[model samples]
Target: MIALPPELLPQLGEGLWHLFTVFLRVSAMVSLLPAFGERSIPTRVRFGIAVAFTMIVTPAVPALFAQPNLLAMVRLVLTEVLIGMALGLSLRLFVLALQTTGSIAAQATSLSQILGPAAADPVPAMGHLLTLAGLTVAVLLGLHVRVAQFLIHSYTFFPIGTAPLAQGLSQWGVQQIARSFGLAFALAMPFVIASLIYNLALGVINRAMPQLMVAFVGAPAITFAGLFLLFAGAPLILSVWSDALITFILNPLEPPR
Candidate 1:
């Protein structure tokens, strides 16, 4: 059996405690992190990711001092979890923005119902596609490395065992939500414009030939235009979304431009 010197026991205990505290925060964040925290990923795999992140982050961050009492320890746990979740949700908003853009586009182009039930989130096919594509692009662009840096930097933004000021946090949350919706609408604007033009042209034709089945003709036309637009515009949309995501990660508190 292996044995450590008696004097080393206290140091070992303190080190373990520090690792545990860091893990509490990291695990909470990983539960909602993109790619790593997807509902499709198994819980065990996510847990393993959390541990890996903890190992990377724990060394960069200063070790937490030993807690003096049970109450202090409980407070530390709660605060760390809260801060971690805030960071995770901030990044998760980018994914939500992509999904929202797809839904808006699908609805505008009358493609909202196609394959709606296939996705885990019950989103339309366009939404599912955009979500998957955005995730893929992010992963391909070294999202894991950026996320590691983000996690390490979070300690500086939110110190250990300190809850953020509630008012500031609320204001920031509202701004992020607003920015997400704005980005979604901006990304889907092309589809919206196409829908508008199609409806206008359909109305003109219906007025000129009242006896014709305009609905049948217009429906297929709009669907084709929607699909073509998606094919041509997806690259640009994903590019813009990627830039926004990276900007947010680098400076979460910056006001949206």
Candidate 2:
């Protein structure tokens, strides 16, 4: 072991403390980050990812130099965790939007029951597909790089050892929830419209030919239409979802347009 000089010792200790503080925030955020924070990923791998992110983010953020007492340290831990979680949840909402869109589309198209149990989560097949595809596209589009920049930029808004105001935080949370649901509905609009038209046509046909079994005829038609729409519209749906996600990453607190 190499002995460090007294002057270098203090600097080394400060560097370690800074690293530890940044790691606390990073690890908390990584627990809910898009690709890195999935339930399927091992805990150890996630931990390693958090460490890697800390290394990348540390250089960009200003160092926290104040020495913390026991109480202050506890406060710091809670504050960092809260801020990290808030940031992580904001990003996670985009994933939730994709899932919600899929669920809405599936239900509208009468495909909700098909392959509902395929994923670990209790979402429908369409939800699983959209969620998986959205995540894949996000990762492909340099989500990791954007995340690093997000982490670094977060420090500007939420500085070290400071807690966000509760009222403002609550307002932001509500806005994000509203925006996500609106986005989901918008993306699933095509399926909803198709379903409405199919139902109206089926009702008219049933009225015109009372002897015919319209349910049997309409069921297959709706199913086929749903599959065809999914095949044709998935690219556009994913594109819109990706753009929304990128916008949020670029400016998280912006109100929905």
- Scored by lDDT, model 2 comes in at 0.92
Q: Candidate 1 on 18-83: residue-level lDDT in tens?
A: 888889889999998888899999999999999999999888988866654898888889988998
Among these predicted structures, which one has the highest lDDT? Answer: 2
Deviation in Å, model 2, residue 58 alpha carbon: 0.4
Top TM-score: which candidate number?
2
TM-score of 2: 0.98
RMSD per candidate (Å) reads: 1.0, 0.9
Which segments of candidate 2 are over 4 A away from where they belong?
A: none
Runs in model 1 deviating more than 4 A are none
lDDT, residue 248, model 2: 90
**Alpha-carbon error at 1 in model 2, in Å?**
3.1
Clashes per candidate (backbone, < 3 Å):
0, 0
CA lDDT of each prediction against the hidden true structure: 0.90, 0.92
Tell me the lDDT of candidate 1. 0.90
